[model samples]
Target: MTDQAVAAAVARRFFGRQRELKALRADIERTGLDTLTGRKAPRARVLLVAGKPGSGRSALAEELADGLTDRYPDGVFRARLTEPGGDPVPTARVAQELLAALGVAEPPGAAEDELTELVRRAFTGRRAVLILDDAVDAEQADPLIPDDPDTLVVGVSRGPLTGIPDVRPCTLGGLDAKSAIELLTAFTGSVRITVDPQAAETLVEECGGMPAAVVLAGGWLAARPKASVADLAKQLRGLTGDPLTRTFLLAHEALPATAARILRFLSLAPLGRADAHTASALAGCSVSAAATTLADFAALGLVSAADDGQYEVPGHLVPLLRAQLEERDRPAEVQLAQARMLERTVRLLQSCRAVTEPEGSAARRKLAGLPRALRFPNRAAGADWLRSRQPVLLASARLAVADGELDTLARRLIASFVRALAAHRGAEAAAPELYGLHRLVLDVAERRGLHRERAAALLNLADLDARTGRTKDALLRYRLALDAGRAANDPYAIGRAMESVGGSYQELGDWQRAGDWYGRALAQRLARDERADQARLYGRLGAVQTYAGRYGEALRNWRAAAAGYRRLDDLPGHARALSEAARVQEYAGRPEESLRTCEEAVEWARRARDTRLQAALQLRLADTLDRLGDPAAAGLHRAAAERLLESRAAACEIRSGFEKD
Candidate 1:
């Protein structure tokens, strides 16, 4: 269904909260509607729709937002401020999500404070409504509230945001009896509700008039058309505290044994959401069976089914389900179940990346051997699966690492996550999360005394730092990684760490130290006969030498890199190396020689089918020709270069459109 259709369906079923909605609307308009006037207040109006779990506060906030779309024409951006595990989501991550929802381009690799500031600035001039759900405290909500009076911020939290200035709080409780009865009538139909008004009232009382519990009771009653409301009320007659919990327990007791077990394991799902695969893995059942059970649960309001085919256990239901899991399953048994689910997740992540490999590649062959259900059909399909499942996949990694007993599994999970994320979303795009996951891996490695993995993790973190221009910080981590590499006797890590240190020094303009580190790294690669590393280090040395005014040495090193690429049969790499040589030739005041070299580099780039490289080389040729007193030839080359770049840009735009679609 379209989003509007779904929202309409929900609005039709929504009952009660009339008075609360009125109060909330009043509170939102207390400072006057932002859309009405151009007058700017000191800050955005913040209204806290405070309630306990199962109080329907989130729904109320959604209803209010839906009604106010006309008032906030700019947008109604929503963000969840807490994780499924009840931990507060970091303010920076929340801000990042908000920024995306606001159609703002977040600066990649930005610090937490910077992202928070960006989010605030994005909403400054816009007349919009920001719905922050499940916020735990003032800190989580405060950073997100915009300063513009033309905007409004509606926060759904457990209680008052104590430290937030001028915040209006609307605490909620049970729905009124009349609205409660009407809600029951909608679920079970008016005929049954009308015939037994006393029984319906008893059931409402038993549910404590909490909208969520009443809905559960009504659903349970509706499912058994033969059962009366009094029957459910009698079953709950003597139950103690928390009507929602009691109703959940009663509904759980009625489920078939397998369904009940699956329901209990649902609590183990990452972020309280599970699809058929998740259910099948957790319950040791077939996907079809799991899907059927989930559908039934959704019908009974035990879980909410999203359009994407995943079922979400209601926030109030998670604790109840967890309680059932603890009562019925052993600790070891629970751990095994979690392990199975995580293992299945890892296999899925593997498949998600493997489908992107060449058809006859080893990864593709391995994918073919997996179950048909696990294999994706194509690269696009694989990427889509990875994108859709990233949240759960990341959550699973966190849980695995925090499990503490699953260090080996956690390491494997983190590795697969890194590869999958990089395959689907480029490394630069996934760098922020990758940095954190690498830290988790480092934590595990340190705890287990695994020096090799420690070096690898440190190197990964250092590379991200280097990417973001933190040269000094990256150099420190590279040095530490080098130490770990030596301790582990990992030759590859040692070479990479040395080369990276040199790169950092080059970025910091310490040409002498950079050259020294590069030479040290070169020696190791040469001793091991690692041609690729030798070529890479030579290029690194060439760059530092060029920066240090050793043009002759740079030209020689670039030529050597070109030769290495030739031996390795890497056309694109060969082309790039030649282009570098041509640039250095021009820098050395040999324009005629540079012209000839650039022409050859352009041919090589064309042969390699590297459009951007060819265009760059063409531009270099044009510059050299212009310097050599050949304006006609220079203009011709310049036009050719423009055409090449335009084609490249157009191709990139097309590819980006496909990705977005």
Candidate 2:
């Protein structure tokens, strides 16, 4: 499928997160062409997206760029500072290119100051966007600066750009564990994430949310189908830098005398967050070696892996690699390697964040050439592979964030987990997964300063709680979520929270309270034309009405719900409606009609493989038989219901004479 189509499909997989997306969108909107420049009204806005490598700084920038590009008619100007082969963009050359993009000619081999002036003159009055990706210190971006008062300049870097004064800075961190796993599920599909959730959780811890490491581990696991989450986790735990093991070893060993020492010493980093000077100190090497190693690591896809000169280590082996690289047995002549590999890895991951997959002949070729283990054949196939590699993805995200590297990719990845539930595994079977993911995402979103995401996470968790019989807790969560939605200005989130509150009341058997909340939710949802959720709400409303002994009203709502489900071709919903109709007949003492309805429910349940529904219908059938005075036959049907309920642990339990078979 096309990338946009794939993205749309991926988007459809999310169960929630409307609140956060709305807030993020608002934030993007707040960042007007002039806003990043602040009150000084400098000729140009030099906003910097700063974070450790793998922190998803690039993704966040891309998100803003994706939404804001339309506002700038001069077009978005993007340039790669770090090349795959590990070359830094020369200041003069970069300036020349920027000038050219702005439709200005630069003097060939112009002096640094001249080039800088040339670039400034090129965008004197234009509303173009300049994205300088994979940047180093501010000095490197000096020549390529935008001069126009209407121009917005975005620079993505691994660390703070100390050289740039008066630039608006945002430090990115890793995705939340839940978001990371969700992204994994979204990319890999359901089969993998659902099989072993606990293992997946631990794996997310291991990788620590370094997107590059997460992606690498995911790619590795995806390359092998039968592998378990624990299996990949075991591998991550076992990664050590000693004895020249792992793909990074040969590269490390082959590094030039200066680069090798810097990299080796950087391995001592505890948190794996680093910069060139940090690497130099750890390696006992000079600044030059550290700089060279930064470029070298990018070429090897170990750190910058782009021209950005942003240094980072792979999250997967950060601890183990640091230990091995720091431990003794080094030749006196051979200096220690760097301590900043982890941060470099974070940066590389930031550069490599491709959510909807790559495009174009060049990009396709570039993706195709990614190490066979690294390249995903297609978005669908990649999603399938990613699903199986959830543990690794989570680990990567956690590592990046916990390292305190200012990466936000891990958090974004967590947001995508909503996709994992609805679209990846659907609502019914993936409930447990959805519950845990929402819990984690909620916590992380709040901690990462994402109020909108926090509300969405809370709402999502409340839904799960209500479903699983935690009505009181669900109500509290929903209330908090509603407050958060209001604070974040998310009307849709507020409506959803209202619905969840109503659902909690229904679950608690408080029909009046439930109806009131549902009414408000329905009104809001109706105004929004969110027909997607009408079927479910109507079905739930009907159930509440039936339980409250409003049979006629229940029948009306049930019929409407049934029609909605039929339009959607939802067999399970149809069966539920039929069963509800049967319950009304049974309670009204219409044995004949009840029996017919029960039979239809039974057929539908069988086709739907809904053991719970079948059990409930069987129990209804037994009750009807009892009404008909066939005690022996009633007992047989009751026995069958008992067997089904006990075996599958279906809901609607009854402590009848035949609770067990």
How does each model score on lDDT? 0.85, 0.62
TM-score of each: 0.86, 0.38
Rate residue 241 of model 2 by lDDT: 37
Best by TM-score: 1
lDDT of 2 by residue, 1-661 (tens): 4322332344334322233334544543355445565654555667777776555666566666655767777778876565322346567556655665676644322367887787777777778878888786677886677656578777888777786655766765556778768755543456887888878777666767555445444444543567777877776677763221333443344456656555555444433445554565556556566666565454344543312223555543454455444464363322222213333333323223332335765545555555443344555654554454343334334444554433354455544544533444456755544554566666677777677988988887777666656678879999999999988989978988988888788777799888778778867766876664776777677777778888777767777766777777787888888878777766766778878878887888878888888888888788788888888988998898889878775344444435784
Model 1 spans > 4 angstroms off = 1-12, 32-39, 103-109, 358-362, 550-661
Q: What is candidate 1's lDDT per residue for 69-150, written digit by digit as tens? A: 8888998889988776577888987887787667676644577888888888999889888899999999878988887887
